[model samples]
Target: MKNPFRLPRRASLSRPWRWLVPLLLVLLFLAVLIWLPWQARQMEANERQEQLIADTLWVEQTLRFELARSEEALAVLGADLVSKPPTPEQLQARLNQMFKNGHELRRVLWLGADGAVLAHHGLELPPAGLAKVGRETLEMARLTRAGRYTEPYGASAHAPGMVDYYLPLFKRGEYAGSLVASYSLKVLLDETVPWWFAQDNDLALLDRDDHPIAERADGGPGRGIYTHRRALDLPGSSIVLATDSVKGTPRLLPNLLVGSVIVLALGLLLSLMTLWRHISRTLAAEAALRQQMAFRTAMENSLLTGLRARDLEGRVTYVNKAFCQMVGLSAEELVGKKPPMPYWAPEAMKDYEERFAGVLAGTITPQFETVFQRSDGVRVPVLVFEAPLVDSRGRQTGWMSSILDITDRKRA
Candidate 1:
C-alpha cells in the first residue's frame, strides 16, 4: 500500500535536468582545457621566431656600423697623409691608437702613386704586393675615387680570412696614392657579435653566391629551425649575414600548470562517474518501488473483499475498486468523504457516527455488521473487519476496514 504519511521525494530519476546540465558543463570545460594550452604553445613558438628575426636584424646593423666606422677612419687617415706627411714614428702612433679602438683590421698599407709601399703596419704583411682581389679593388677605388672592400679571401699563412678596404688618396684632384686596410672576417665576427648573443646563436658570413666564408658557433651548430639573414651591404662584393639560433622552440606555458589542469580534468571526470553511479542506483530503486506499487494495486483490485482506509481524524482516505462497488460510488467520490458518508444507510447514521468517533479515538471494533445504501437507494447488508492502519514506518496512522456483502448468505 502507498504510505499516506510519507511525503514524496522530488528527486525522481525521470527528471534528467539535474545531472544532464552538469555533464554538459563538464564536457565543455574539458574541451577548453585541451584547446587553451595548445593555443598557448603556438603563440610561444611565434614569439620566439619573431625575437630571433629582431635580434638578427640588430646584429646585422651593428656589424655594418662597425665596418663603416673603420672605413671612415681609413678615409680620414688617407686625406691626412696627402695633406701633411707624418713621420714614421707619428704614423705608427696613429695606427696603434686606431687599432686599439677597432680590432677588425689586420693590416694597413700606405702606398705612393707609383704602387710602392710608403708605410705598413700589421702583425703579418704579404710577401706579394696584393692578392688578385686586393689589386682589383685597389684599381676599382682609384677609378671610382671612393673607398671599397675587396672580395673575401680565405685564410693563408698570414691571416685567418680577409677582405681589404681601399681608400684612394688625391691632392689637387690628382690620384696621389692608395690606403689599404685589410680586415679579418673571423675577427670581425668575434669583435662585432657579443658573447651573450653568440651563446644562443651561430653567426655566418655568406658571399654573393651564398657560400659561407666564415662562421662562429660558440654555442653549437644550429638545428636550422629558427634562422634569419641580413645582407652585409658592402662595396666590391655582397656578403650576407646569416644567424642560426641554437635555441629550439620555446617551452609552452609551464609543465606544472598544464599537468595540474589535466589532473583536475581527470578528477572531475571521476567525480561525474561517481555521481552517475549513485544516480543510477537511485533510479533503479525508484523503478523497483513503482513496480511494487503497481503489483499491490493490481492485487487489491482483484480481491472480492472491499477495502477502505481512513486517516486518524476519521476522514476517508482510500477506497479500492471493490469498496467503491460496495458503497455504490466511484472511488474518487468516496475516497475523501468523511463520516455522514453518502454510503451510510439513513437509519444507521447514529451507529456510523459512534463507530467513526471510536476509530478517531484509537478504539476500533474488530468485527461488525452494517447496512449500506446503494446509489439506487436499495439497502444491502455487509460484514466488516476493522483494524488499525499501520504505515511503512510501522506506526498506526489510521484505520482500515474490509467489507464483504452478506446478502447471498442472508437469502440462504
Candidate 2:
C-alpha cells in the first residue's frame, strides 16, 4: 500500500525501435539477395544478345571476305582465259592456284564455256563433266542483282560441294564464262565456327531464294528462314532463338533452413521468456516445435507437388520433382535455364513475361495465366503469382513466383 500510492514511477521506458532494428536488417538482407541476382541475370542475358549480334555480323563479314576473295580469284582466272582459252596444260597449272585458294582438288574442278574440262584438281572420283554446264549454273546467277554472290546450286562435278559464292564474270561486260566455287556445309559447322562461339548457338545459311540451305542446332529449337509469297524487289531473312521451359532451384533445404532458423530462434526466445512459467508449458512448446519440423519435412519430401523459382528474366534456377514431372523435363534440362520468350504461339506467354518485368520494376504485381509446353510436346496451363523479393528498406531486388498447375482446372 505504501508503494501503491507513491506516485507511479515514470512509465517503464520501452523503445519499439529495438525490435524494429533487427527486423529491418534481416528484411534488407533478404531484399538485397533477391534483387541483385535478378539484376545480374538481366545483365547476363544482355551479354548473350550482344554476343549473338556480334556473331551475326561475323557470319556476314566472313562470308563477304571469302566472297571477295572468290571474286578476285575469278577475275584473275578470267584475265588468264580471256587472253587465251585454257588448254589442258594451262588448266592444270590453274588447278594449282585453285588449291592455293583453299579449294580441295577432288571437291572442285573446272569447266570451260563449251562445257569441256578446262582444268581440274584433286579428284579421286569426279562427277560427270559439267562442260557447257555454264547455263545450268547461270540459271541461279542471273537472279542476283548484286553482280556478285551467286545463288545456291546442286552438285557440280567441277564444284561437287554445295557452295555460296560470287560469279563476277558478268562484271567483264558480258557473261564471260562463269567462275564458280562451292563450300562443304559440314566443314563450316564443324571447323569454321569455333566451339566456344558455337555453344548453345544455332546457325543457318539461307539461299537467295530464302530457303534454308544449311542449318545447325544445339539442342534448342532450330532456326529457320521464311520466304516471301509475292515476288518483290528484294527478299529478307530472320533469325530466331528458342529454348525449353526453365528449371527451378532445389526448394526443400532452402525452405527448411529458412524455416528452421525462424523456428529455432522463436523457440529459444520463448524458452527464455517463460523461464519462470510452468515446466509443463515449456515442454508443450518444445513438443510443438518438433511437430512443426516434422510437418515441414514431410511437405518438402512430398513428390506429388513440384515447385520452381524464376528470376525476373524468366530464367528458372530452382525446380522440384513435381515441377519437373509436370513439365516432362529433367531437372538437368530446366534448372538454371530460361524459356525462350515471345512464346512461339500463345500470346499469353509473352504477356506473362511483360507482366513479370513490370513487377520487377516495381510498377505493379500481376497474376499470370499462361500455357507452357512440356518436353513431351504437351501444353499445360499454369497460374503464376509474381511478387517482388524486397529487403527491410523496401527495395526491390528480384521476384519470387509461386506457380500452380492449372491443367486440371482448365480441363474441368
The digit string of per-residue lDDT tens for model 1 on 232-270 reads 888886888898888776565468979798789989999
Candidate 1 whole-model C-alpha lDDT, 0 to 1: 0.85
Each candidate: RMSD: 4.8, 36.9
Could you estimate the TM-score for every candidate? 0.77, 0.42
lDDT of 2 by residue, 287-332 (tens): 6665675565456447555555566666666565666666777767
Winning model by lDDT: 1
Measured by TM-score, the strongest candidate is 1
